[model samples]
Target chain A: MSKSIFYHAGCPVCISAEHDIVSLIGAENVEIVHLGDNPGSIEKAEKSGVKSVPALVTPQGNVLHINFGASMEDLK
Target chain B: MSKSIFYHAGCPVCISAEHDIVSLIGAENVEIVHLGDNPGSIEKAEKSGVKSVPALVTPQGNVLHINFGASMEDLK
Candidate 1:
């Protein structure tokens, strides 16, 4: 039930983001719910209000998602 | 047996590529293998020498992969 669940669809960005989060929270602190592999988890994520991939469900039950855009250099 | 198989891990690029390929060949002609979703298919993909996502396996057993780099304009 650690699922401080990180829901990912396995994009490179998602992969990297998961790595960073795990490093911060410690691997044992989180559960990775892959939306692609775990269809059952999809409903759980949706219940948490996840409408996209790379979602993180905090232990407190809030859903956090991301949108990758141009790199900093591109912002100029 | 339509698996002109397309192996993807659900990145935006992979998603777009899959869409384009299906448009070209027709959905009925291909089998979409999501590596994250189908753990069972990973073995098949590896046997076919798939080293990355967004891979396409032709009906004849040919594997095609890509490495996305800077856009063409970036070369200037």
Candidate 2:
């Protein structure tokens, strides 16, 4: 199974934390979509019910993450 | 003073309705920032306390709007 992570590069927290998540999850296992650079990204985000940034979308089309300026521990 | 509007171009509603708002307010009166294309956009959004897309930012750095799939009339 593959996982996709959608995030806006404009968010400092998202940018910083995404790196860590990618490191932990292994970059090969995840697809990173920078919403800021892609016009169609939000459509995917909305379809997956994403209301916030640094969100994770699974290959099954489920949105499973949100970043609210919380720490890494809180993220888990 | 100029007013700024921050929105993600990836959002269908934001893209569609921004045109109207621009027409209503006059393009010269507003600054449209496509957060999806700008890396620093969300920082400005966070400073304005925006938690959603299609949000409007005023010259005074106030976030004044949110689009929740409402119609034009309902939006006003």
Per-model DockQ: 0.02, 0.02
Task: Give the alpha carbon lDDT tens digit for every residue of B1-76 in model 1.
Answer: 4347878777776786667556544688778977767667777787896766676677666554532322222222
Please give, for residues A1-66, the per-residue lDDT of candidate 1 as tens digits: 344777777767777666655654458867887766767677777778766666556665655453
lDDT by residue for model 2 (B1-76), tens: 5556645455666765465445434588677877667746666566677666665565555443433332222322
Model 1 Cα shift for residue A44 (angstroms): 48
Shift of residue A1 alpha carbon in model 2, Å: 1.7
The total number of steric clashes, by the backbone 3 Å criterion, in model 1 comes to: 0
TM-score between candidate 2 and the true structure: 0.41
Give a tens-digit lDDT track for model 2, residues A5-66. Answer: 64544567677556654543458767787666764666666667666666655555554343
Question: Which stretches of model 1 miss by more than 4 angstroms?
Answer: A1-76, B67-76
